[model samples]
Target: MSKILIVEDEDAIRRVLKKVLSEENEKFVIDEAADGVDAVAKIKINNYDLVICDIKMPKKDGIEVLNFIKKFNQEINVIMISGHGDLKTAVEAMRTGAFDYIEKPPDLNNLLTSVRGALKAKVVKSGIKKNKSSTKKGKYEIVGESKKISDLKDLIVKIAPTNAKVLILGPNGSGKELVARQIHLNSLRSDGPFIEVNCAAIPSELIESELFGHLKGSFTSAHKDRTGKFEAANNGTLFLDEIGDMSLSAQSKVLRAIQENKIQKVGSEKDIYVDTRVIAATNKNVKKLIESNIFREDLYHRISVIELNVPKLDDRKEDIPDLISFFINLISAQYDKKNITINEKAIKKLSSFDWPGNVRELRNVVERLLILTESDQITDKDIVKFSGK
Candidate 1:
């Protein structure tokens, strides 16, 4: 059922509108608000598919309400209503992002048709939201039962709901990116975009434009206006991987964006405000960088409000057995091969080695064993040949 809110100060018109909307379809669950203030309060508490707001009302007007909806809930369709047929106000309403405009005494047929059309749009938005939620499930799984892994999972659950800036710390190939992604998956902005930028991968000269964007023809190589990661991640999560590798100049700009929630394009002075939840990961020792005057101390403090350290595979050896089995099934499915069994001795031998490269290295070794082994099962001999002990 789609919920609709009717914002009108007049009780009689409100009742008639409700009657007309109720007669349209049984799926329409309607609510009435006597004024704009009441409408906004209801909007804050409940999710409405469409709002029928009066252009002129007490305490607040339709334009004010429309702007508020655009700011917070862009998905909701709004239909502006008024007794006085003012073309200017109707045009203003449409320009301000109203779905449609209907002058009162609303033609029953016209109103019904408009309402149905607006409701169709609502259905489409809901379907997109549903598909996004489905995609988010099982997208990033932190596989392990060790105390270290469990503690990290607990911390993620506690902090994901809030818009806290997270700093993930770990060695190279220690699954820091995985931890950052998991945090994004569980966050309030899960339905929004997840923008990832690899600081170390991009050249220092182009990193500024890569992050803050630039206007076309503003620079020598500029051909098209580009939207940066921050704008791309507006109302979503931005994962800055290998953040310690970001240039000091870029770090200062990033610090400003974090402080003000606004960023300027590389070629433009106009500030663009973005509601991006930043989750930065770094394998490099940022404190040492700070002491060396390469990384800004203030920027470091800004991004590390919630620090999470991923445990190295050597430190969490209890998880090796589970990791091996996970990779076996995962790799087997990917390669269209039936998963083979690994004997106890093989497991023991694999777990005994010091994995300097962490979980990432273990996954690679498991896949190598699956592909290189001749028998139906991975045995102690396979481990002796493939496990670089």
Candidate 2:
């Protein structure tokens, strides 16, 4: 979740911006300030991910507020709101470290774009910091020996060496990401980066700009030339998750890119060639989506060069013991605890239930057992207490 601050003296503009931004993303927690002084007082108290400030206010101006935030917490991004005559001051504020500035009667698209970009930048920075302290973990393993899983492993080894556009079908939390990572690691492009995009998470209006790069002046808030995922994942594997939810407009452009091995930026006519391998995944049935006219048939055929269906946990219940053992050790180490052994009766109890949420939910239950259970060994009573029953 992202916390945002809107600092504008005008009640009408502040209320409108707050309403629109709240509607844009439900995860946003928004706060409003009537003046720069009030904004500074709140900034000192709450840790905001982004701030939208007005330049000309009755009290302290936007530049002062930006300076205060930069001095207080340089990581918090600020987007200045400038009037027609305040463009020069806005530019100065940018030089001082504002993320971007919007003119009065702000373009809805530009404001939203700037806000999204700022939040995304903060998240990337935080992730990088976390990764720096993390241990060098080994490759992601599909932790099951069921016949279905074994067959999937054999198929992955055969297809990974080739640059085939593979489509993976599975229910949510059935390890679709794990499968994609395994393929990328075994593929010829293992030396390159593995980029993953959740199609359902990005809004339809910004999908094009997110995939294909945009020029500095392409949109009202395109402050600088940006590299999109296609360019970022060049000579690597681009994993598009939840592809069935992508808008048809973006789907056509993606189809063009796959067909020609080239993609034009959002506002450019010239094409940029890329040697990218695309792997797509979706939980929905594409054939049904096509019949409903929600998904493009040509795009579906193009991406589904080799379709791999991952079985849900219910179908592979035979592997529950191995999966339980794997998660016990994996999650226990994260909490700095010794590996807690599970009794045979507890394992049997876990295996008997139907897991609609699949491996993801099971892992959560294991973690809960590790933390909440009193005994070193996980027994039937432990399973009953914290195994998500």
Candidate 3:
């Protein structure tokens, strides 16, 4: 259970926040404080996983409370509640160590999503060890025992200790990011930050700035000096997902960084040397892209020092049952539902189909079934009605 403290001077708002959280998930053990002074007192005595604090408060303000927490326990995530007038202060509070901020009369959806994300990140930041033998799994835990998965696990164990760059190839939703995360979590540099960038998501024009950062007035929207992924990931791991989608110009810059462990800001001549481990992943066939002149061959060679291919669901269907069981437990906890049982016929039916979207699709189907099905047991009919496969 996650212990959350709702700190608000307003009685009604505090009550509403507690109500929303408790209704969303009973597992949230919530406490309340009327003002920042009480909040600081409670925080001093209580171990809270999250704090929902209003930006404007009596006695002590949210910023002061946030500073206290940052100094007291950096692990505790604070979500600032902001009114219209407090927006600027809220942003500053975020820079001051707030996890996220929600506007007044909080959009419940955004509030809940932020809460979940903050809690999830808290787990990752806390560096909790995964129980390899248990069904209760971390988001990045590799959950399978098939020959291919077994071999993949073995390879990760072998390569994780080295500073070798890895190129992970797989279909979309095949858990490529999970593999990248596992590599970082088990590596010698596990204590450092793990920064991830989706090359495909950013525009080609901004990709360079996104990776290498920019100085004040570097571009039209470059308001101030910004740190890029390469710099942020210094002395850690930088995961470049969908490298196949990266532009040739950006690819050349990436190659330079990989070859020389140095990067330049977009509007600066100064070189910043960093000891960052690069891990790249792509769903596309990189070699074909190379032949088509879309991806750089030299960059490819540098990143492919250790190649790891995450198998698609069809290639590892034998692991579906295990995956299903794992997801059931995972999604159940996320939704605050009791663990539901899946019949053999349901599991068999699920395994029979080719999951075009791979493990990701399967998890969605499981979540769907858990929500749509009325009974505690999930069967083939539930699969038929909800799986959408």
Over 1-389, each residue of candidate 1 has an lDDT whose tens digit, in order, gives 89999999889989999998888887788999998888899999999999988888889988888899888797898888855556457656665567666768776654675677578756655555432233233746778889998888777764564455789999988888888887788655777899999999999988989999999987899999999999999878899999999998899999888756689998899998777778999988999999999999988866876789999999999999999988898898887778587999999999999999999999999999899899889998998898666
Which residue pairs clash within candidate 3?
none
**Each prediction's TM-score versus the true structure:** 0.66, 0.65, 0.65
Off by over 4 Å in 2: 1-137
Overall lDDT per candidate, in order of appearance: 0.82, 0.84, 0.85
Colliding residue pairs in candidate 2: none
Using lDDT as the yardstick, the better of models 2 and 3 is 3
Total backbone collisions for each predicted model: 0, 0, 0
**Native-vs-model 3 lDDT?**
0.85
Q: Model 3, range 71-142, lDDT digits (tens) per residue?
A: 999888888898867755765675566766777888676578668767875775577432333122246899
Top candidate on TM-score is 1
> How do these models rank on lDDT, best leading?
3, 2, 1
Error of 3 at 283 (Å): 1.1
